[model samples]
Target chain A: MECSVARTLDVIGERWSLLIVRDAFYGVRRFDDFRADLGIARNVLADRLGSLVARGVLERRQYEARPPRYEYVLTPKGRELLPVLLTMMRWGDRWEADDDAAPVTLTHTTCEHETTPVVTCAHCAQELSWGELRTDPIRVRIPAR
Target chain B: MECSVARTLDVIGERWSLLIVRDAFYGVRRFDDFRADLGIARNVLADRLGSLVARGVLERRQYEARPPRYEYVLTPKGRELLPVLLTMMRWGDRWEADDDAAPVTLTHTTCEHETTPVVTCAHCAQELSWGELRTDPIRVRIPAR
Candidate 1:
């Protein structure tokens, strides 16, 4: 895929893949815990976890050696997806959920204040809405596939 | 179902659905233009467009009466997803693209500075890392279906 957004979607666009990542963010590690929280089929969960690990978005660590228990943990690359998930949650709270029924409120521990995330310019730190930003793309002509 | 991320994903999580949205953002409105850019099958594109219009993410407008031409435009609800797309694109440019080969560069029009997006705390304006945030979610016990 020539487009960066499409490439990103290829990795984690599915509902299940994202939900798995969400669970991992909330400290769900063991397979059983993921299953418990997600109510996901065992085979499907295994498949998604395996793919995430292969893509380096997650890692499998042997937490117990007696019976060889392995737990999934987000890798550095996986942690970079935080903003994507945060923005998605904010969109849902505003659009889908009933008024005053936001399922979660995020608190910034560094600031000791409750906050939502705002996407801002990396250089100037101005908050970016759709109209404020313009893309000057280096257009690579991807052959129509 | 109780999770907002999952709920938002329910609306636009599929790869094709998102790609269609991406095309819309890039000013692709007519069906033929979207099909040309994405090379998506006609049936699939039509189905996704219909669903988006039904969900109020997109609205259809008739531009020509003689030949009956219609175009799809993002609604305000849909435009609000700008942050999510920005974050996703940034992540992809960093992780998926070859180093220094970013497909697009975004400019903050007001600042006249080219920048990438940074996710920040809405309250304190500090840049957010995954570790800096804590969630106090109102956990609604959803029955595992």
Candidate 2:
């Protein structure tokens, strides 16, 4: 489908794109910062940065003159991606980590509790992690190539 | 960094991969179901399914004999991906959408309200959105290739 969601994912779905954006969320704005934070190759970093700038997710601003260095700042589009990144962080925190360092601890502002976000069904209003959801009966087939 | 949070993203940062997982959460378990719901190319879907199965997120079980039909079901590992998908849907529904046809809607069980599952600060518990977050002053940099 040519939906905006699909379109947006097309731009950001590549290997290191979201992680680069995550670095931006962490306040690593420069090209060098992203390269450092991600350990991504310079070419890959340059390409992803170029794509983000093209998509209006980021804008390149000169940070230095003689050295010809630039910093990337989040545009409204890029800033809009925080929720996605946060969600990834939340998931990574829960399922991927070992005992020593938890990925992140999301603190609740109103309840004063450090918590992870849960998805509740809009229909049932139940917080469903994994086991809570049942299969919907309607099924479709993937066409053979 | 060697953190799993970083590591997990390395595995699942693709756009279609996450979308496939999201469809699974909606109870779309079969290959055909994913193909129809996502409108993804057959080859890409095949590759993604194979990758997910190999990674232990999904399992392929033969359901029919003559035609050798198979169904893709989420394993516990795949089921654990629900929160991550929920967070993405929640974000898309909020800052990204232009109108009432939101990316997705969620339900909360405690109050039985079909409210948006917002990411609030773990400390104050106030609903946090992308526009609200600022960078932590501490700059954590990893290696760059």
Candidate 3:
């Protein structure tokens, strides 16, 4: 459970949490929009949003003073979760979507080319596929008695 | 709700689900191994494993005939989830772990280098950092009513 993946999941592992973050990436900022877009129950949406804000994945910014209405936006920490969402999207596109179409297509705005994103080694910059990568046994630093 | 990411999450979004899959990736195949490694309660573990098997993410193989002992292994579909887990691990390393250490070290076995995996555009092979990507409004193909 000390693993980083587990830790990251600790903050955003709830059922509706990552979807809310994904909606934020799509520029859906308001509570009503998130609720409508996700088709999530109201209380569930509220809870997920509150937990996301509490976890620093999203922050509330007031846009109305009369009723003190607010919208949520991704924090710096949340925005950095792009890869996590993207990879999931890519996996979904590959495994879950119809063969002819993906529900969402990712566009690299700078290159202006639409494409699937991939994982590559930071050092060699080679695209890593299954069977190309391996893990060494993790060495626990606990003191031996 | 019909989005691929949502569909993918439908398969693996439950609490401890991905961790169970993570344990599978680490070669923890036997039930006791998964239970000991995850510290998950037996009932919860059994439920998750059954769901994983039913959903095609994992499959059970009978290893002993006398008492019908079984072990789980990732299927091709499950194995394709590599990027999703890698990105999560990378995010944890950067955000959750201390500057000096990460709990797990990923190695590019083919390249034989110790490194972090990053996301890149499949088309341009350019490293995609934050803010370099953008999304177009998805064009729904539904026939106009």
Best by DockQ: 1
Per-residue C-alpha lDDT of model 2 across residues A1-145, encoded as one tens digit per residue: 3233445566676778777777776668877767766778999889889988887788999978997878888887787676566666666666666668545454443454555555445454445544433322222233445
| Model 3 chain A poorest ten-residue lDDT run | A136-145
The model with the greater DockQ, 2 or 3, is 3
Each model: TM-score of chain B?
Answer: 0.90, 0.75, 0.87
Q: TM-score for chain A of every candidate model?
A: 0.90, 0.73, 0.86
Residue by residue across B20-129, what tens digits does model 3's lDDT show?
88878777788888777778899999999999999899999999999999999999999988888898988887778866664677778888998788889988888886
lDDT of 2: 0.65
Candidate 3 stretches greater than 4 Å from native: A99-102, A134-145, B98-102, B129-145
Two-chain DockQ for each candidate model: 0.58, 0.29, 0.52
Pairs that collide in candidate 1 are none
lDDT of 2 by residue, B1-145 (tens): 5454465676576768877876665567787778878889999999999998887788999999999999888888777776666555444444446574534334344554555444445454455664444323334453343
Candidate ranking (DockQ, best to worst): 1, 3, 2
lDDT per residue, candidate 1, B70-101, as tens digits?
A: 99999999888889899999999888986656
Q: What is the lDDT of residue B52 in candidate 1?
A: 93
Consecutive 10-residue window with the lowest summed lDDT within model 3 chain B:
B136-145
| By lDDT: ranked, best first | 1, 3, 2
Docking category of candidate 1? medium
Q: What is the C-alpha RMSD of each candidate to the true structure, in Å?
A: 3.4, 5.2, 4.1
Model 2 vs. true fold: TM: 0.72
